[model samples]
Target: MSDKGLHKTNQNGVSRRGFLGRTGSILGAMALAGQIAPSQAQAATAGAAAAGPIDNGAHVPALVIGTGYGGSVAALRLAQAGVDVHMIEMGMAWDTPGSDGKIFCNTTTPDYRAYWLRTKTKAPLSNFLGFPIDKAVPRYTGILDAEEMGGIIVYQGRGVGGGSLVNGGMAVTPKRANFGAVLPTVNADEMYDTYYPRANAGLGVSLIDPAWFESVDCYQFSRVGRKHAQRAGFPFVFVPDVYDWDYMKQEAAGTVPKSAVAGEILYGNNAGKKSLQQTYIAQAKATGKVTISPLHKVTSVSPASGGGYTVVIDQINTTGDTVGTKTVVADKVFFAAGSVGTSKLLVRLKATGALPNLNNEIGKGWGDNGNVMCGRANHMWDATGKVQASIPCGGIDNWDAGGAFAEVAPLPTGIETYASFYLSITKNPNRAEFSYNASTGGVELNWQTAWKAPSIAMAKTIFDKINSKEGTIYRTDLFGTNKIWGDHLTYHPLGGAVLDKATDNYGRLHGYTGLYVIDGALIPGNTSVNPFVTITALAERNIEKIIATDM
Candidate 1:
């Protein structure tokens, strides 16, 4: 890992030693087996029975590599296809309030190791592959080296749903022109005609009405953004978000009591937003098609003699402790672990020769959306007393030839009020250097901001776009600008095991078969919008081709 001093020791006090030797977790039909969602409980029970001894196959067949965005979609799709899918999540499942007193991990606080940190993410593929696995612990910083600290810290959620839980519930599919430009292989219009809406309804995105925004405290900040954007003459669209507008309205109305609304949502939202914990993964569970095995990390990928593959797992918790890993074999596998997770796993696997011939296109073209966040604020009163900054109400496009900017609206509980303007690159190809260090034998992310000359120019344009456009809350008529980069503080990351021009545009790892990266990791380029929708859509498109025809 390139981050040496960045990671603080596990604050939850779950020592790496305490986590390793703990095992003997067995669940029979009586141990809450009947409680599975209509879809996947049976698979959970089946996996439970087959999971006793690693190779014994007591339960947990059809290992799905992640429980995050793409993996969640894949698991549900496979499960609905009647494949007994075992989904692996490195972080423990959040304890949803149940009828009984049975305790689950409370993600709202650091009650268990899972809630110990403010920032979260995932990468433990499976226990089957050995040697050369990605790091499972969620580190706070990626590459802070000389980058400016900007507004609204961008973090990833680590637990069962990966970043979906921690994210602000922005359900983004970029503008038509922007989305189509990335996939040279797939027909952009055809994809829009086919996969985009399918992916949206799957994630449950709805519009934010102005009346609803009028009542919510967090949403009030967006009006400031709209005013500023209108002043700057930029097109500001009230975006569709995964966050439930009805629930937000209820929270604002005080009828729906919420700790989530009380906490302002950056660290984690337990009560309000409909993150994956409450949505697709939930539905996936209901489908009887998918089963989840939390705290198991993928070690490597090895070709089995039986014409399929084995995904080795580390079986560890968030505290860097061991919990006895497993090696499960799957006739078909999809790597949906996020960009960093999947890339490191595939790259290291290839480097150590565990799964050889991973092609020359394996670990290159890693980009972080050329992401930047900055703010422009002034102490001014709105009609409602003050403008509490909210998520993107609008953005500027013209100046950013290679990027786009959105006013990131953040409604902190009290006192400080600000909106975060996020700049996702429209055309950033600045590649970050990735190498496996033998001294530590881990992946190093030497992401230098200096490499992003075009993006830097675009970043300056976007922020200037944001600044030159509006000033409703400020005292001055003309906006003064302050620009900065918060390390690589972006939830959107692409590339690293990218689609090489040298390889097929389908993003084959060149030399590997029976191996396909189906997550955000396969997108070797950046987009001007949040990358998840595109990632999920692309995964849907890829899997449909792979399993339906390629199989």
Candidate 2:
């Protein structure tokens, strides 16, 4: 899909001639045309023609603030709806490989491997992913600060794809009831039935390597959890992942690298998972109605007359160096920055009177998964040092497991036939208080940890249940041996700007005409498992709505 007018292609994907034939309407095409090197001949040629109205000019110019899960999906649907969507990404446009601030590898072609080589961010995108806090980039885009969380590790990716480039790509839709828990007011049947599947198709969600869980080595860990749960009398289960199994099979066949074989995930699995960059954003660009400008950070957003806005952005250079400042107007604006990022931005805007007409629910109902962590004992042997050898079997709906409960699908390292033990836990309302530090112009999260006690208690109970039921199939080795059960850290932080009728249900600012917020921040409350699929689904749901009605 070149940037030209709607070039009707015989095939499915991008068509060259049709697109390039309509490049006259493109904005600043000549500027980028020459800037692109010969290597980007196709992209450059397509960019020339990738501009024009697709239909009845029904499309309005929309500014999707971030290219993360939500904004990226929004851009795609909006473009499909014939809306002119200008995707504003605050990070680098990963045309090269490396971390946020550093480049490491170079790409040889235009495949996923080549794309990965072009981008430098790593998955398990935690604080460790960037430079140390003291030397870290001044801007606060969701980069983790290991030192700040008592040396806890949390990862976040930057660049055009956002975290999608660095995520494990394990898309698991939360249980229907889980949705029932977080967002009580939203219609679930339509969401799970209509929106969920739509998001799945868009994100390429599916179960991969189902038999892998049954591997002699994999179930070993589940046994360990069983024993621990028995001892304390708790329940646990398995959940499916959204990974593409066919890709993994090819990878395991040696046609691909081991990176696809359950390895390289925590650091940046090069194998099978699909990120937002590869799927939705790329697809959106193909529509020609969507244009993403990366390496530019948003400075502010002001409402424009007739349901539009003016966005101030700081253009950043290829080297992550600030180049200049510019402002772009949009017929509609969306705040898809993740929870911490979006809430901070909105909280500041609300407090500073920038959005003086904001609602009271701007930053309320703040809660994470009531995250709690603990280890179970398996006295059969020593622990394996593998970062993530096995994924979770699923989760438990004990009605006692916080809002939910689940355990890792145990996998034994080939070296140790004994069942591998795990330390997993979650809570119902691991709340965080969003207090505006007026002088600093930033949002401070003072966590209101009410679920702490219940989380820890549930962890212990689950461990006891596993032990009494499954028995010790293996010995245990804790990550931090110094601590006991239920003593790990949380990475699945959720809910800063919760969703409800108060916020217009779909995350539109209650009183605002065109401003919308999408991201993890809009999570109804919390999910028992990782929230990527849920997040992306909600984004898919909302973005489609925006395209159908608002845009």
Candidate 3:
């Protein structure tokens, strides 16, 4: 078979000794370090499950909405401080395996299990050679949710892990200088020295073993990406990830079930990736002071006449039906439902008189993190390898001059497509505002599809350079035939209820004593990298202060 076809098939000549030699030692070390065992993890979850549902006007001391990085951190820290915390999630629990014995559907074969409430799949790379590449899928509550707004498609994860369930696992911390600029009011010294490190450790962020990366078949695409970037006079940096290196090595060696190598990210990683569900959420459950209610979507948050918040939630079923409406009275409420989710809820509440005192900055200062995805048509000699891994390990950092950090993303089509794709986080200063629509009883984001022009222009500063150096041209087939950039969507939506403006410096809402705005909503606009690590560190910093004083 050709090399392209060879890579499509499973690696041959695997042996038990070879597998154990590479992975066993690493697993042993991890186990020796008192990592939570499977049974212990299950026991912790059972303890949290033992807490009964908070339906029918049940009251709790603290209620966290959404289970993303911010909510997970808040829940864990609050629980660890001996506070009873309850989390409400709109997504389903992803721990249980389906009838196919998998927690998520692979990217190579998307089905009803790949999307959330969509009849048709909406992949980031939507087409090839003028032909639509996405297929029809059943309308079900899947993992990745492509929520449509007025002018942009927001991609978010839906499950216990939230964005962690569907993201690329690229746990990137912004440069200290850039981070300080992003959030000027935040104490840079405290964030860089304390919270960033703390968040990295809590999230299990680690660099790829350089030696292993050099030899791994799955990383050949990244190496090619590095080569082109360096040749074009750009710096290629190794980006840290939340994936376990030992497990990835085992997957490449064909000694274990594959996740990253088997095209697992974007939907979910069935193994190896250390999502928030496995870390903070699990630890919170172990405290036995935190209980999570999945499939519970918080609709409104209004002040109760009794000096607390009244939260109305809809219990959704597997088929996306709102089966029941429930109420919870909480002393505190945290808006951690991500940038879009939180912004939508807040804008509606402010306009509908539920939270009339909310500041005018409720849904202002929103941005797409300057997200732009593009692809380059490389020569046949620049083969990006057929064995491309889904979890990206490196990126081209032209942020200093070009205002863009471009990840050498994988085109894990299970075949050699002879294309190089990149997802760039640029420094686009364009901001959108979410306004309440009185007619539709919904929120509208006043961001035109054309607003992505600046982001696309910023990204071209890097790709255009490389393309010129390599004598290559942009690929129109990847995103859509004749379409050079996928700029109508954002995977990293930041801002809306920004820190210090919409809330206090510590994430507390201006008018509400007990309400907080955590998650990506606190970011002013852009993080210049993947927003999760920054979101996490900011949460760590804010929650630490909140626990010490507010609680």
Model 3 weakest 10-residue run by lDDT: 22-31
**What is every candidate's alpha-carbon RMSD to the true fold?**
12.6, 10.9, 8.7
Q: What is the clash count for each candidate, in the order shown? A: 43, 70, 0
* Model 2 lDDT-worst window of ten: 20-29
Return the TM-score for candidate 1, rounded to 2 decimals.
0.75
Q: Which candidate leads the pack in lDDT?
A: 3
* Cα-based TM-score, every candidate: 0.75, 0.73, 0.91
lDDT (tens digit, per residue) of candidate 3 on 1-551: 01121011111211111111100000000000111112334323322323445677799999999999999999999999989999998877766555466666667677655777887778777776567767777666777888888889898888777888878878787776676778999988888778877888888777788898897888888888989999998888888777777788889989888877876776777778778877788789999999888778999999999988999999876668887899889999999999999989998998999999889999999999988888888899988887778888788887878788898888876767678888899999899999987887888889888998888888999999899999999988766668898887888989999999999999999888899998999997799888898999999999999999988
| Candidate 3 structure, TM-score to reference | 0.91
Q: Residue by residue across 1-551, what tens digits does model 1's lDDT show?
A: 01111111112211111010000000000010012121233213212321222342323435667767778877777677677777766555544222222122122121222223213221111111122221232321111111122221224455567766555555666666554456656678655766766677676666567676655665555565566556665656655566555565555567764433443343344454556656667778888666676656778778777766767777653344675767677776667677777777777887788867777666677777766544345444533223232233334444234355543444332444343334334465666645677777887676765555566566555456555544322221111212244333455667776644313555445665645676777676575666767777776776666556544
lDDT of 2 by residue, 305-385 (tens): 544776677765433456677766677888887665677777777787777787777776665455554344445453433
- Could you tell me the lDDT of residue 4 within candidate 1? 18
Sort by lDDT, best first: 3, 1, 2
